[model samples]
Target: MTPFIELFTPVSIRGMTVKNRVVMPSMLTHMASVNGEVTDRLAAYYAERAKGGAGLIFPEATAVDDSGLSYFRGLSIAHDRYVPGLKKLARAIHEHGSRAGIQLGHGGRYAQPEFSRSARRLVSYLPGISPEEDARVMDKEEIERLAGCFVQAAERAAQAGFDMVEIHGAHGYLIGSFLSPFTNRRTDEWGGSFENRMRFAEVVIRGIRRRLGPDFPLSFRLSSDEFLPGGITVDLAAKIAAYVVHCGVDLVHVSAGMIDTNRFTGPPPVLPMGWNADNAAVIRKALEGTNALVTVAGRIHDGDTAERILREGKADLVSIGRALIADPWLPHKLETGQLKKITPCLSCNEGCVGSIGKNRPLSCAVNPRVGFEQRPARHVENARKVVIVGAGVAGMEAALTAARLGHAITLLEKDSRLGGLVNIAALPPHKDIFLRLIDHMSHELVENGVKLVLGNAVSAADLKAMAPDVIIVATGSRPVIPGFLKNSSAMTAADVLSGCPTGQKTLVLGGGLVGAETAEFLAAQGKEVAVLEMRDEIAPDMQGRARAFLMEELSARHVKLMTGLEVRSVDGNGVVIVKDRYGNEYPLPRYDTLVAAMGYRSEQSLCAELTREGMRFVAIGDCVKADKIMAAVHQGYHAAKAI
Candidate 1:
C-alpha cells in the first residue's frame, strides 16, 4: 500500500530470484564453530529471519581459504566440511521462499591473532603502502592459490544450493588491502599501478566466474573510497567498478573503509546513518550501462528511507546494518503498511560497533532481542490476566512483548500518558536518540492491544480488585540527594529536566553522567551554569568516545565544573560549599536552579508487595535497581519469558 511495500517485492538476480527486495547483508553472525562448522543455532537463527520473511539472506563473510579468516568464528568455505551445514541453511532459507548467498573472503593483512594470526608468517613482503603495513604479505604463489580457493568456494556454494556468491573485497580486509593504496604495497603484478592494484581483485572475480559460469549471480562488494587522501578515491573506484563489471560480476556492492582515513566520511554526525548512500549511488552510475546490481549503506533507519532510495535510483539495493539490529521485523512491518509502528535504529553504535571492537558479539542498545532471538519474549502465551504497575521503558517493553504473545494485559501509569522519565530525559541535550525509544515502545504497546490504565499507581486495593494472575511492579525510581548537601532552592535533576521552572546562573549538584549532560544541555540553552560534585572526576560513567565529545562540547559551551567540593548549605542567593581538594570555602552565586543529579533509589517496596500477594510477579526498570537501558530492556524481555 505504501511506497515501502514495493521495495519488499520479489526481485531476481542472475539465475536466482528472491522473495523480497530486502536483503540482510553479510554481518558476521559469529555462530560458527571454532573449526569453521556452522551449528544448529546459526541455521535456526537464519531460518527464523527467513520465516519472518526476508527476501534474501547473505550470511556473513565466508573465508575462502584458511588464512583468509581473521576471526575464529567466521564461516569458511576453505574445507568441504562447511558444505553440509551450508546446505541445511540454504534449505531452511528456501523453505521460506528466500534465497541464500555466501560472501567469500580472505583477510590478507588484518588477520586476527585469535584466528590464523600466526599464519601471516608464511606471507611475503609489502611494496607500496603506509608504514603500518603488516610485514607479512602474500606471494605470487599464495595469490594463485587463493584464487583457486575462491573458485572452489564458488563451486561449493552452488553444490550447497546457494542462490548466489558475493566476493568480499571491501572493509579494509585482505581483498581491500590489495585494493587500497594505504594497505597493499606490492610492486609485482598485483600492486603498483591502478591496474596492478586491481589485479588480485579481478583474479578472484574471474576465478569464481570460471567455476560458476556466467549466470551464477556473482556480486562484488567494493570500497568506493579509502576515505584517505592517498587512498582509493571515487575516481579510482569508478575504474575498479568498471573492471569488476567487465569480469562477469553480476552486482557491485559499494561500501567504505574499515578503520582510520575512510572511517566516517559522507555525512555529518556519521557514526552511522544515511552517509554511504551517495557513494553507493556513484558506484551505481559507474555501471549504468553494465548489467550489475549496486547496493549501498553506511546507515539508514526504517523502511521509508530504504524504499525512497530504491525508487529514486540511489542504489539498486539498500543494505541496512544498524537498523535491522534495532528491529528485525522492520522490512516485513513496512511491507504490510506498518511503517509508523517500526522501531527506528538509533545509530548510536554503542553495542553494534563499539562492542564489536571489544570482541563481544554485536548487539543493539535499544533492541535486546538482536543476537539472542532464539528465545525472544513470549507474550501472554496462555492469555493470563496481567496487571502491570508503572509504565516505563521496562514495563512498556514487558507489556508489549507479553501482549504480542497473546496475553490479556492492563498497563497502569500514574502519569496521564506513557513514557515515565523518557518524556523529560529526551529533552536533555543530544538525548534525541534515547527519546526515540520511548515513542517507539509506547506506540507498540498501545497498538498491540495493551490496555492502558491512566492517572494512578495501582494501590494495593486496586491490585486486589483487578485480581490479576500476574502483577509487574515497575514504579521506577527517584533521585538521591546526600544529607550533607544543602541548597534550599535545590530540586532534583528531574525538575530542571522537566523544565518546570528553574532560575538562571544555577549550580548543578552532582558531576556524574546526568550532571555533565544536564550542564551541557543548560549551556546550550544560553544559561550560565556551574557544577559542584564531591568526586574527583566528572562523567566517569559515560562511554569513552561519547564522554570525550560531551566534555569538548561542554568546554566549548563554557560550562563550569568544580570537582572535589562539598556543599554545606544553600541560601536564597547562593550555595555554601567547601573545596577540600583546594582547601577553601566559598558560596558560589546560584540565584537560579539547583539540581540533584546524584543518582536514583529503587522503588522495591511496590515489588515486595506484589511478591507477597502470591501472584507471578516481575519488577523491572528503575525499580529492579537503576542502571542503563541495556539492563532494563534485557530484564524486561527475559522476565516475560519466565511466564
Candidate 2:
C-alpha cells in the first residue's frame, strides 16, 4: 500500500481524471521568450514536474491580453501565434502521464508598466501606489471586452489540447480586484453590492464556459480572505465559491491573502502548515451540494499533511507549489514509500518566490536544478576520488552529486556535526524547517555511500596522503566581529544561536537578517532584546514575505529596533557608545549581553593554502564569497558537475 494512500488516490474534477490528488499549482518561472512565446526551457520545466508524477500540472499564469502582462517573460494567449508553443507545452505534460492545465489571468492594477501595453486595467480608481493605479475606470463596453479576452484565452487553451484552464481570480489581479471590496470602490452595476462586486468574475467565468463548452474542466482560483478590514473574508468567499460553481466552474482553488498581504502567499515556515485549510473547509462546505471540487494550497508541504487534508474533507485535492519546486518527484516518492528520500522545502522564499519577485528565473534552495530541467545530471565515464572539506550545504551537495556520478567521495568537517552554518541557522525561531534540508542531504550521502568524516580537520599533509583526484573546498564563512567588540565581552550572533548563554537584557548590534533573527530568538526566550543598525531599515538584505513576517514577529515580541546608528566605542563604565548618521554620539542603555552580527567574511584560507602548495582545487560556497544559501548550494551543484 502507498504511504500516503489518500494523496496517491486518483481523483476526478469535472470529466477530467487525474492520476493522483497531487496538483502542481501555477508558479511563475520567467522562462518564456520576451514576446510571451513559450520557450523549450519552460516546456522542459513543466515536463519535469509532470514526469515526476504530479497528477495535474499548471505551468505558471498566462496572460489573456497584452495589456495585462505582469511578468516580462510571462506566457500570453492574446494571439493565435502563441498556439503552437502552448500546444507543445501541453503535449510535454501529456507525454509525461499528467493532465495539463493553464491558468488565465489579467494583471490589471498589478501589471508592470514596462511589460504591459497599458499599466491601467484596473476595475476602479485606486490612488497612486504604482503605475498600475494610474487608471480610468472601465466602462460597460470595456468590461465586455475584458470578458471577451477571457473567452478567447480559454478557447485557445482548449485548442492547444490543455486538460483544463484555471481562471486566475486571486491575489489582487484584475478579477480579484473587482471582487474585493477593498479595491472595487464603485457604485456602478459592476460594483457596490455583493452581486455587483462579483459581476466581473461572473462575466469571465460565464464567457469561458460558453466558449469552451460545458465539458472542458474549468477551475477558479480565489483568495478566501484578502486579510483586509473590509476585504473578501471567509463568509464572503464561501458565497463567492458557490456563485462561481453555479456559473459553471468545475473546481474552486482555495487560497488566501492578496499582494498587500503577501506574507501569507507562499508563506515562510513562521506560519503553521496547511495555514489555509480552515478557509478551504469553509469554501468546500459552501460547495457541498454543487459538483465543483475544491483544492487548498498554502504551505502544505508534506504528503502526510496532504493526506490528512483529504481525509478530513477540507479539500478534494491538494496543491503542492513550492515543495514541488524543491523536489518535483515528491508524489512519486510518496507512492514508492521513499519518504526519507524526498527533499523538504525550507519555505525560506529566498529562492523561488524571492528570485521570481526580482524578475529572475525561479530556483530552489534545496534543489539547484530548477530551470535547467532539460540538462539532467549524467554519470561521468571516469569516476575520480573526490575529497570535500566542509559538510555544510555546499560540501554536502558536492559530495552527493559526485557520489551519485559514481565518484569515491569523502566529506570532512571540522565540527562534529554536519550542516556547518545550517546548524546555527536552524536555531532561530520558526527556522527549524531548514534542518529538514540538511537531514535529507545527510541521509542521501549515507545512502549513496559517501564517506562522512566529521570532527576531523583535514590538513595539507592529510590531503597529500589521501592523494585525491579532485578536491572541493567549502570551508564556509565566519561571522564578522565589529572592531569595538573585538576586545570587548560581546558575543557573535552565531555563538548565541549555537546555544551560548545570553543575559537578561541583550543588545544586538546589527539589523540584518542575522541580527533581526537573533533578536527574535533571544526575545522568545523571555529575554529583553534590542537591535541597532547603521542602516535606516532593518533586514535590508531580506525581502518579500520572509522580511514582512520577521518584522511582525519582532514587533509582537516588543524587541527594540534602532536604525541609522553606528557603534563608536565602549566607554570606561563598559557602556557602548553609538553615533547617529549626524555624528552625534549617545550612550546606549545597560545590557548584560551584546552580540556582534555585522555580517560575514569568507573563510578562504584553505584556498590560499592549496594555491601555495601548487595544488588545484575547486572552491565553492562562502569559501569563495560569503552569500546566501542559494548561492552556495547552486555553486556546489555546478562545481561538482564541472568536475
Candidate 3:
C-alpha cells in the first residue's frame, strides 16, 4: 500500500478519471497578457505544474465577462477570440498527463475599475469614489448577462478540451457577492432571502449544465464560511451546497473568506494548518448521498495532512494551492517516497501574494522557476570548480545548483549553524517552517556531494590558495543602527529574536516587517512592547492580509504602536520623540530597553576584498543587496546556473 493511500487513490468525477485525489485549486497568477489573452507564459506555468503530477490542474480564475477582471493581467474567456489561446493552455496541460480544468468567475463589486475600460467610464460618471467604496452593482439585466457569460465560458472550456470547469462562487467574487448578505444589499430578486441570494449561483450552474450537458464535469467553489460579521455562515453555506448539488453540480470545492474583508482567502503562517477543514466537513456531510465530490483547500500543504484529512473523512479530495507554487513536483515526490525532497511553503506571502499585490509576475520564495516555466537549467558542456562563502539560503542554493550540474563545489559558513538569518527568523512564533529550507538544502548538499565547511571564515588569501574557477559570496547582511541611536544601549532585532533579555517596558524602533514581527515576538514572551515607526503606517512592506492580521494580533496583545514619530535622541531611561505630522515633541513612557529594527546593510567587505585581489567571484544575496529571501534565493539560483 502507498504511504499516502487516501491521497494517492484515484477518484472519478462523472466520466473523467483523475490519476489521484490531489487537486491543484485555482490561484490567481498575473501571468496573462494585459488584454486578458492566455499567453505562452501562462500556459508554460500551468504545464509545469501539470507535469509535476497533480491529478487535477485548475488554472487561475479566468474572467467570464469583460467587467469581471479583478487584476490587470487576468485571463478571460468572454469572447471566442480567446478560444485558441485557451486551447493551447488546455493542450499543454493534457500533454503533461493531468486533467485540465478552468475556474470561471466574475469579480462584480470587487472588480478593479482600472482593469475594465467600461468600469472607468462608469466611475467617471459617478460621484467621488473612495478607495474603500464597493464596486458598482450590476442591475438585473447585467446579472442575467453574467449568467449567460458563465455558460458561454464553460462551452469555450469544453471546446478547449478541458475535462472540467469550476464556477468560482468563492472569495467574494460575483456569485459570492450574491450569496453573502454583507455584499448584497439589494431588495430585488437577487438579494434578501437565502434562496433569492443563491439564485445567481443556481442560474449559473443550470445554464452551464444546459450548455455542456450531463457528461461534462462541473465543479462549484464556495466559501463555506465568510468569516465576517453578517456574512455567509457554515449552515447557510451547507444549504446553498445542497441546493447546488440538487441543481446538477457534480463537484463542490469549499473555501472561505471575502477579499474585501481580507478575513480569509489565503491563510498566512499565523493561522493553524487546515483552518477550514471543519467548514468543508460540514458541507460534505450536508451533501451526503449526493453525486458531488467535496474538496477543501486551506493550508493543506503536506501530504501527511492531506492524507489525514481524507482518512478522517473531512472531504473527498484535498487542494494544495500555494504548496504547488513552492514545489510543483510535490505530488510526484510524495508518490515516489521522497517526501523530504519536497520544498515546503513558508506561508510568508512574500513572493506569491506579495508580488501579485504589487502587480508583478507571481514567483515563489523557495522555488525560483515559478514564473519562468519555459526555461529550465541549461546543461554545462564543461563544469567548473565552484566555491561559495556562507551557508545561508543563497549559498546553499548556489552550491546545490552548481553541484547538481556536475560541478565540483565547496560551501563555507562562518557560524556553526547552516541557516544564517533564517535561524533568527524561525525563532519567531509560527515561523519554524522556515527552518525546513535550511534542512532541505543541507540534505541536498550532502546528497549531491558538495563539501560543506562550518565555523571557519574564508578570506581572499584562502581563495587564492584554492584557485577556484568560480566563486559566489553570500555572506548576508548586518543590522543597521541609525546614527541617532549610535551611543545608546540599543540592540538589533536579531538580538531580541536570539533570546536577548528584555525589560518590563521595551521600545522597538522601526515599524517595518522585521520590527513589527520582533515586537510581536517580544509581546508573546510576556514583555510590555511598544513599537515606534517613523513612517505613517507600520509594516508598509508586508502583504495586505498579513499586515492586517499582524496589527490585530498586536492590538490583542496590548502592544502599543506609535507611528510617525522620529527619535530626537536616545537617553538612559527613555527616548525623546518628535511627531513628524506636527512639530510636537513629547517624552514617551519610560522604557528600559530599546531595540533597533531599522533594516539591514549589505555585508560587502568580503566582496570588496575579492575585487581588490582581482578574484573571479560574484556577489549574490545580501552581500550584494539586503533584500528578502525571494531576491536572495533567486539570485543564487541564477548565478550558479550562469556559471
C-alpha lDDT score of every prediction, in listed order: 0.74, 0.89, 0.86
lDDT of 3 by residue, 488-546 (tens): 88889999898888888899999999999999999998899999998989999877777
Instruction: Report the C-alpha lDDT of model 1 over 589-621, residue by residue, as the tens digit.
Output: 644667778888897776677567655567888
Model 2 residue runs over 4 Å out of place are 128-134
How many backbone clashes does every candidate have?
A: 8, 0, 0
| All candidates: TM-score | 0.84, 0.98, 0.95
Selected candidate, larger lDDT, 1 vs 2: 2
Candidate no. 3 TM-score: 0.95
Worst 10 residues of 2 by lDDT: 128-137
Residue 115's lDDT within candidate 1 is 79
Q: What is the full ranking by TM-score, best candidate first?
A: 2, 3, 1
Model 2 residue pairs with clashes: none
